[model samples]
Target: MHSFTVQQINEVLQGELVGNTTHSITGVEEIRNAKKTDLTFIGNRKYAKFWADSNASVAIINDTIDLEPGENRAFVKVKNADLAMAKLLEAFQPETPVFETEIHPTAVIHETATIGKGVQIGAHCYVGKNVTLGDGVILYHNVSVFDDSTIGPQTVAWSGTVIRERSQIGAQCIFHNNVSIGADGFGYRPADDGRGLVKIPHIGNVVIGNGVEIGANSCVDRAKFNSTIIGDGCKIDNLVQIAHNCIMGRSCIMAGHSGLAGSVTLGDGVVIGGSASIKDHTTIESGATVGAGSGVMNNVKAGQTVLGYPAADSRDMLKQWVALRRLVK
Candidate 1:
């Protein structure tokens, strides 16, 4: 961790500095775990009680927080403590390794592939025919980019991820370990002559927009016709499944274990909570939030909050929960 004097930190964060300006801060930590050399934050009002006794020499605090008399601690007051802390953390974060332009000897790159300047292909990876990788793209060990796929500049794909044929990923996207992009959709037809299911070929690809981050072990299926789209700035959490032809709008967030069935549509800024499931062909309007463990079977109006299995409005769900508790009593 990098050390910074409180005065220097003040210059960086542009916060109102209070108390010992010369104190050296070594690292960031939680309030309960902070040491004299560590910086902590009180972003919530409930956490203010811990601040008075905290060992932290420096803290990031909201502008409106109450500072009691006789408190000797130093703090940087900002409009939003959480955002300020995030900025500070970014400044102190270590630099990531950028491999040289040369592909590792163990990597298999087709002769027909187009690799841009400063691209890094790690060991045991495969870049198939006509694949186009943008400048400074990094494919870590065991990554595979199948034929005709295009990856935008500065995108990083971690180990064991697969970008299937014809997929298009936008700039600055991150694909975590074991992510499967553009896998065939789960589409099948009943076989004739009393046979088993017959596979339906997915003819389209997955298109991920700029600055998207797909978490580890998530799978995004190829579309039956057009693209299965993940819009700009969307964040998908670990173990999420985005099925065939699903479309997510810009800045939508899907929490861990959430699943979107085939052709589901999410408007901009929709938030799907952990383990939530959206049924096929459903459309969730902009700014809607689906509560944790919800099963959304139909359309949700803009800015609505839904909860429960076969989700209803949050107010109704709360009333029902209260009624159930009364019955038990």
Candidate 2:
């Protein structure tokens, strides 16, 4: 545990100190789970009542809120308590000692592949032929990069993330555990003989832009003949399925369990709530919101907020809700 005086924290975070600055505290802790010698935060107004019996020595809080405890607990008042706590955590975080450059004996690398400077390939990681990994990229244990795949600079892939052949992922992107990109899309036709279905070959790949984040267990499939494109700054939640050839616009938020059919286009700043299904070939303009559990069946113009099944206007949905509420008699 790293210990710092209350005065040192006040100078580093630029917060006003209302209690003893000479007191020393070690590490950061939540208000509910705090112990002695720890710095706790009270961001929620509901937790204000618990401050009287708080076990921590120092409390980081806002000036306007009243946390009138019987005992004197050191208070560090700031504009935003949550933001101040984040800065304290970032400063006291323990960093691992970096090792000097050396390749392990168990790793195998192709002679023709391009490996940039300052790259680390951990044990049991396989770098295939014709694959290119940019600078400062790290492949952890048991990671695999297929042939002709290009991973940009300073990106990290957690455990068991498989990048298929010929796929392109941009810089500073993060793929969480079990994220599958550039996989074969679900496309099949029923056979005439009634025996089985025929699997259609997916000739295209996926193109994910920079600053995109995909949650765990989500799969983005490649297109049948065109690329499955995820635009820049799009944040996708866990278990979301982005089908083949879906062109998502910039800065859109897709919540959990939401699935889009093939070739759908969503404009910028669109927000989708949980478990919404968008129909194929539909175009939703910018700043539109699809409510939770909505089934979008048509193109929604810009700045529209929709709700319910086949998603009507938000005002209409609320009007119907009021009329239905009185029918319980």
> CA RMSD for every model?
1.6, 3.3
Evaluate model 1: give its lDDT: 0.93
Residues 78-189, candidate 1: write the lDDT tens digits.
9999999999998789887656546899999999999999899999999999999999899998999999999999999999999999999999999999999999999988
Clashing pairs in 1: none
Top candidate by TM-score: 1
Off by over 4 Å in 2: 21-25, 59-87, 92-103, 192-195, 291-293, 301-303
Cα-based lDDT at residue 16, candidate 2: 78
Write candidate 2's Cα lDDT for 1-329 as tens digits: 68988788888879877767344688788776787778888877887877776677788888778754334467888889999988888878997435244444666877778987777776666777898988877666556778788888876666677778778888878777778888898889988898899999988989988888888888889899879988888999999998888988998999999988888899998998999999988888999999999999999889899999979899999998889998865
Winning candidate number (lDDT) = 1
Ten contiguous residues with the weakest lDDT in model 2: 96-105
